[model samples]
Target: MMYAAGLAGVAVTMLLILIRVLLGPTVYDRILGINLFGTKTVLVIALLAFLGGRTDYLDLALTYALINFIGTVAVLKFMQYGDLGWAGDVEDDSDV
Candidate 1:
């Protein structure tokens, strides 16, 4: 009963986040919305696992959370550097 209410609340919040991701005024705003959505997804998975008495789902949720974190970091890095494999500034000495 209470779990169902919590799930409903999370679903509403996720819907709002999805809207922000789609209509965000800036790229950063969209990125933040995506991150928040991922967090809510993890919460939903956790709640479902608890409600179903399936602890194995918690492991899947953890894995998804990790992937979500890594993906967000990768996207942010690409946005900042324009490339995922960007290396820091390197001094050129071969001309000497």
Candidate 2:
């Protein structure tokens, strides 16, 4: 029915995002693709839960979204600072 068609569309979108992730020209582009893929995954899980009449799956989807957000932030931070634990203090290069 309509739900099945919606699922198919989402699947196609996810496939496209995967291609972007694989063929992205830059690291940031790949990272953006990954973030988008995660978002689509969340949507897919939510739709599946609705299709199955399972409320618990909605909770699972929310948890996955939280993890995705945290993971994306950690990765971007690591990419920018070269360390996940970097403090926000600017290094004094004048002593060199």
TM-score of 2: 0.87
- Tell me the tens digit of each residue's lDDT in model 1 across 4-67: 8888999999999999999989999999999999999999998888888897999988988899
Which stretches of model 1 miss by more than 4 angstroms? 89-96
- Global lDDT of each candidate: 0.89, 0.88
TM-scores of the candidates in the order shown = 0.86, 0.87
CA-RMSD of model 1:
5.8
- True-structure lDDT of candidate 1: 0.89
The per-prediction tally of clashing pairs is 0, 0
On lDDT, the candidate that comes out on top is 1
